[model samples]
Target: MQADIYKENGFFLDEWQLLEDEQALPTEPGRFLVSLERFVAAPEAFASLPEIAILVRAGDDVTVLAPHLDRFTMVAIEFAAFSDGRGYSSARLLRQRLCYHGELRAVGDVLLDQIPLMRRCGFDAFKVVHEPTRRALETGHLAEVPLYLQPAARPDEQPAGARAWARSPAGLAR
Candidate 1:
């Protein structure tokens, strides 16, 4: 695999402007994406790309696209800067309220510190801009733990899956 970035929450800087020129897009037409400007400035563009992916900024006019999300394959949210956490909330809404199952990627300012929280809010992949050193990335790996956890061990969070599992015999054995 050529390392597709739908796995990270960062922007693929090399591919940022790939769609600026309409003709540059793949003629086969499988996935399409729109920048925040295009979606906000011209809603018609959404209709033009039938099954495309889109990129949106947190502050952009996202409400306009709410009704048209089903037409998209994925909606990649741009962080622009790491300090901006608005994208996280947007991702949460897309998954929880909108019921968006398509790919959701986090691009731009993808810092190492944000992956865990990003996944919680519904981001599946990232185009991590600041690729961490081998040691730093490896440190976060918990071999003893399962691939996933419920409730996140946060004070106010709860996991329905974990709760249900705890009621089962298998859960009781653990």
Candidate 2:
């Protein structure tokens, strides 16, 4: 699992493994990933475990984590399907709106092409189960357009023509 998890520093083991169902909590004693509903229901149940954070699924209200942001070490947004872009908005809200400063992770159905967009949206870590993505990330072989047309949490320079919407990578005068 370590090699599959990608971060800015490099791949690392998922210290707090993700749990799909709350019913499976009994088997996982220490730190683990919990659902939005389960964690919001009774956060005190896991008050002692700092590593136990919530995994918000697509369409789930991320505002619920606002009050409990201080208690979490990480927040993982699930992308059940790669085509579902709901997780991207969720990540944006967590970072830009709520101002969460913890480790924001992108989990489930993460692909090679989505990594750059994910980082721009404020995802610091990614759970890449796709082999091609892992290989590309491990080899530093990625194809991404450094220019952007929309604003994001990660700051970018002006692309060209002074167009407010367009942005180029930092240090590159476009």
Query: Model 2, residue 70: displacement in angstroms?
Result: 0.6
Error of 1 at 153 (Å): 14
Please give, for residues 1-174, the per-residue lDDT of candidate 2 as tens digits. 246778877788887866666364544357788889888888777765647778999999999888888878889999999899999999999998999999999999999989888888899999988998888888998668667766667656453434543344543555
Cα displacement (angstroms), candidate 1, residue 112, comes to 1.8
Quantify all predictions' global Cα lDDT against the true fold.
Answer: 0.64, 0.82
CA RMSD for every model? 7.8, 5.4
- For model 1, the stretches where C-alpha displacement exceeds 4 angstroms are 1-17, 21-30, 46-50, 133-174
Per-residue lDDT for 1-174 in model 1, tens only?
Answer: 223363533223323323652444445545556675665566664565556677878686555667777776778889988789899878877877677888788878876667777777777777644646223444554122234455442334556546776788998999
Full-model lDDT, candidate 2: 0.82
* TM-score against truth, every candidate: 0.63, 0.83
